[model samples]
Target: PVNRLDFGTSGLILFAKSAEIQAKLSKEIQEHRIERIYYAVVRGVPAAASGVISLPIANIDGNRRINEGGREAETFYRVIKAWQGYSLLEISLKTGRTHQIRIHLSYIGHPILGDLKYGVKSDFINRPALHAGKLDFQKSEFKIPELAAALPEDMAGLLEALQA
Candidate 1:
């Protein structure tokens, strides 16, 4: 794994089937060839419907921190839908890093619900309301070149609740 995706953040996680594939996967990631999408229910609605977060990430003595001196990262997010007191968000990462989404969201003042380190606890939910919703990639070496997985039942439930 590139880095631990925050505690509740979910979405597509790409894993190589072989060592050789791992090298290719790394290259693809560096080249921005892979497509990843995430969905989450944040505490508050963001000002804009869509935008990007360009920041650097680093760990402060093993504690994840968004330090300016660290590697650059990019996070793009769009407001999927807004609810009574929250907004559903779709996020994509341009550069994978430890806790990239969580840290970036917090940096912009809209931390994911139930995200403790980067956000305040939520009374509505006990766990971080984030999910790795989908992933798309070309598998040139395999017979089936493309594949996708739907969100889990619990995650689907969260979406249902958000829409309700």
Candidate 2:
């Protein structure tokens, strides 16, 4: 999950159907064959329509931190929709690490809408505004199905309010 799904980023997560599939899938992850699409609610609008975030990530003790000495992590983000002081985003991760998206977004001053750890002060929805909207995978002998999870109630409710 992208930096803790908080209490709201509930969506598709791929699980291997068998131990053999799990082993193969694990290997594919290292090769970067697994793809993930995330949607997020954020405060304020981003200046650019879309861009890439390249940052090194390392596990510092128990927390993930951005550092010069860590492994490379990349995130691709684009604004999907916006209203008032908020915007929806489509995020893709090139390299998966703990908290990669959250840390990267926060570093850029965007931070997910209700993320408490990174810094969002909203009491109405006090959790990271992220969801694993889609997943795609490739395998040689077998086909790993593409998956899509529906938006959670809170996020849906928020969107409903915004639309209304």
Using lDDT as the measure, the top candidate is: 2
C-alpha lDDT score of every prediction, in listed order = 0.74, 0.76
Candidate 2 residue-wise lDDT, 1-164, digit = tens: 21234344577755666787778766666566767789888777788989999999888887878899899999999998988877888998887777788889888878886787774756446567788887676543447577778888878776776557
Runs of candidate 2 exceeding 4 Å displacement: 1-8, 138-141, 162-164
The superposed Cα distance between candidate 2 and the true structure at residue 49, in angstroms, equals: 0.7
lDDT at position 151, candidate 2: 82
Q: List the residue pairs that clash in candidate 2.
A: none
Give TM-scores for every candidate, taking all chains together and pairing residue i with residue i: 0.81, 0.84
- Using TM-score, give the best candidate's number: 2
Q: Candidate 1 — worst ten consecutive residues by lDDT sum?
A: 139-148
- How much does candidate 1 score in TM-score? 0.81
Residue pairs with backbone overlap in model 1: 10-131, 10-132, 11-131, 11-132
